[model samples]
Structure formats: structure tokens, C-alpha cells
Target: MQETAYAKINLALHVRSRREDGYHELETLFAFVDRGDTLLAKRAEQDQLQVVGEFGGALDDPFGNIVMQALGSLPRPDGLAITLEKSLPVAAGLGGGSADAGALFRLVERAQGLPDDWRQRAAKLGADVPACVESVTCVGRGTGTDLEPIDSDLTGTPVLLVNPRVPLATGPVFKAWDDKDRGPMPEGTAREIAEAGRNDLRDPAISQCPVIAEVLAALGKSEAWKVEMSGSGATCFALFNDVEARDAAARAMPSDWWQMAGLLR
Candidate 1:
């Protein structure tokens, strides 16, 4: 079976407070884009994961991979060979890896009946895995594992994703987060993500990787409704009023950066 591991985009991320386990308490609106990696799994005698794509080499060890951790979570009666087509930029704050694990978990759940505590098991793979499993708009709280589904109607919303190709790790960015919070997102459905719904990681991420700012500025040059960095850094998205404008901006984007335009699902 094959599945598309959609990229996880943070429409708005707010780092609420630091937790006891050194992780930050966060509340962010999570959304998935059409652009992302693809996973193909098949039943085989020996189980193994073969990654093939631009950033596949970065994950040298498969054992320590989230995909492997997910398989370990549930007992597979039949060994399966999984191939990951790494299309999304790694560590670019698009949740490429987390989404991959989440996609695999879904595949496993269907192939082999997963446990009732599957959501928690998915969380064990990573904090973001649980939300990625659903691959929809959600409010991520606590360590980002505690999820509360939100009814967001972004049907015709045009979005353009641009990245400078710089991989910014989340750990350092969180450490660089300011003393003050970005305040919590007001309770309600966000048909259109408000400009006030800010991304707290922006400042620190920009401080570390200035190119991200440049991408944001590039997107700003266009007539977008709202433009901001997606997650930690690098990958910034511009929500245009329509798909035509968004696609035009994406096509005109500099070759130095990676860009993709699509209507939000």
C-alpha cells in the first residue's frame, strides 16, 4: 500500500511555557499541505525501510528513525518493507519526518489492526506523530502531542510555500524563544487564519537563519493575504487571495529557493 505523507504546516504556533521535561508547552494550529514525502510499504519476509530522495542520506541510521519506532510500537504479524520517497525538505520546519511516521502508522493500522491506544502509541513515535496521523487542522497543546481537533474551513484558501533550503533544528530555535509568549490563539474555528495569529518562533528563527526573513520578504512582495514562516524556520508560506496569484508568485520565485503552490486541503 502507498500513502502520501503530507507536510505539516503550522498556520500559527505559540510557545506557551516551558515544561518539566525540557520541552515547551505549545498551542498551534496545524494544517497539512499537498506537497510532502510519499511512503510505499509491501509485505516481505524481512522488514526494512529504504529511504530515497534528496534528504534521504541525512537519515543514515534507520533504527533510530521515527518510521522504525512506529513499527516497533505495534506488532506486525507480517514483516513489511517500506520505502520512503523524501520529497519535502528535512528539518525545514515542515514536519517531514514526523509526518512520515504518522503516515506509516496509519498504513499499519489498516494493514494490521492497531491497538485502541494507537494515538498514544503514535505519540510515542514523536510528539507531532499523533496529530500527523489525522493530518488535519488541529490545536496542538502540551508537548504538541495533546491535540484538540478544530473545525477550520480553508477550502479555497490559496497557499504558497517557499524555503531557502536551510535546515533549522527545532531544539535551538526553542532555546532562542523570547521570555514573553505570543499569547494563546482565541478559542474558535479559523476559516481564514488571522494575521494576529502569530508565529512565536519567527524572531528567534530569523535571528539564527536570516535567509528565512529574505524568503518572507520575497513572499511579501506578492499580493498575499498573509505571509509567515511555517514552523521552526526556512519554509515560509504566503496565503494569497486566490490560486492564480499564488501560482504565479511561486513560478516567479528565485531558483535558489524551493517553492510550491497549492490550495489548502
Candidate 2:
């Protein structure tokens, strides 16, 4: 069986306040791209994983990979041999690891079935895992695990994702936040919320990786309807009205930068 680990992008992330537990209270819009890493699996005597693709080298330790942890989290009476195509850049605010784990959950779900406490299992893997397991546009609150699916107007919209080829870790980015209540998220369709809302981490992320500004500037030059940084730093996205416009923007990116163009899932 095969599944696509859809690339995740935060249309708008509002950091409400810093929590007493280290994690920040968050209200964000999570959207997935139709293109991302691919996972192929088949029954085997033992759980085995092989990573291959453009960014596969970044994940040197197969045993340490979150995909393995996800496998360990579930009750798999039959071992599965998996191959992960790592197309998305690591630590680039794309949720590549979480997406891969989510894909594993999906594969297992299809072969057998998820347990009643699947959400809890996903949450233990990561705050973003639950949302990624569904891989749909939704409102994520409380550190991004609490999901409320919405009728996303942005569905099937053309989107271009660009990264400066820099890996920005999530911990430092959140630590750099100013820790101010940005208030509640605006109520509206996903597109409206994305347009009206803002990613509070933009400034902090930019402060950490200044090249992010260059990417945003470049995307801003396009005829995109909206351009903003995803999750934290390094990677930014532009939403366009049509595929031609999105592909044009993708072509216009710098030669050294990494980019992918796809429709929103």
C-alpha cells in the first residue's frame, strides 16, 4: 500500500499566550498540499524503513525516525516494511516528520483499524500528528492538537512552497516569540481566516532566519493572492488563483532555493 504524506502549511498561526507548561497556547489554520513525501509499505517479518529522496540524507538514523516511533505506538501484529520518499525539507516548517508518521497511521488504519484512543496516540507522537493524520484544512487550538475541521474555501487552490534550504528548529523559534496574547482567531471561512489572521511567529522566525524575508519578498513579487511564512522560519508559501500563476511564481524562485507547486488538499 502507498500513501502520500501531504505537506503541511500553517495558513495563519496566532500564538495566544505562553503556557505554564512550556508549550504556547496556539490558534492556527492548518492546510495540506497535494504533493509531498510518499510512503510504500508491505507486510514483513519485522518493521523496517528505508529513506530515499532529495532530503532523505537529512534523516540519517532510521531507528530514531518518528516513523518508527509511530509504529511502536500502535499494535501491529504483523510487521511492515516501509520505504519513505523524503521530498520535503527537514525542519523547514513543513511538518515532514509528523506527516510521515501520519502517513504510517493512515496505512495502518487502512490495513487494520485505529484504536479508540487513536487521537491520544497521535497526540503523543506530536501536537501536529493528529491534524496531519486527517490531512485537511482545519482550525487547531491548544498547541495545535485540538482540531475543528472547517469547510475550507482554499481547497484545490494552487499554492507554491519555497524554502531557502535552511533548517530552522521549532524550539528556538517559539523561544524567540514575544509572548503576548494576540487575541482570538477571526471567525470566517478558511480563506477569510487566513487573510484576516496573521502568523505571530513571522517576526520571531524572521529574526532567526533573515533569508525568510527574502523568500517572502520574492513570493510577494508574484501575482499571488496571499504570501506568508509557514509554521516557523525558512519555508514560506504563496496562494494563487490559478495553476499558471502558481507555476509562474515557482519558476521565478531563485535557482538555489527549493520549491514545490501543488494544490491545497
Specify the highest-lDDT model's number.
Answer: 2
Q: lDDT for each of the candidates?
A: 0.84, 0.94
How big is the positional error of residue 228 in model 1, measured in Å on the Cα after superposition? 0.9
lDDT of 1 by residue, 40-100 (tens): 9999886799999987988888998788878878887888899998888888888888999
> How far in Å is the alpha carbon of 132 misplaced in model 2?
0.4
Local accuracy of candidate 2 as per-residue lDDT tens digits, 179-251: 8887888999999998888889999999999999999999999999899999986799999999999988888
Report the Cα lDDT for residue 220, model 2.
99
Off by over 4 Å in 2: none
Q: Whose TM-score is greatest here?
A: 2
Give lDDT: candidate 2, residue 139.
94
RMSD of each: 1.4, 0.7
Q: What TM-score does candidate 2 reach?
A: 0.99
Clashes of each: 0, 0
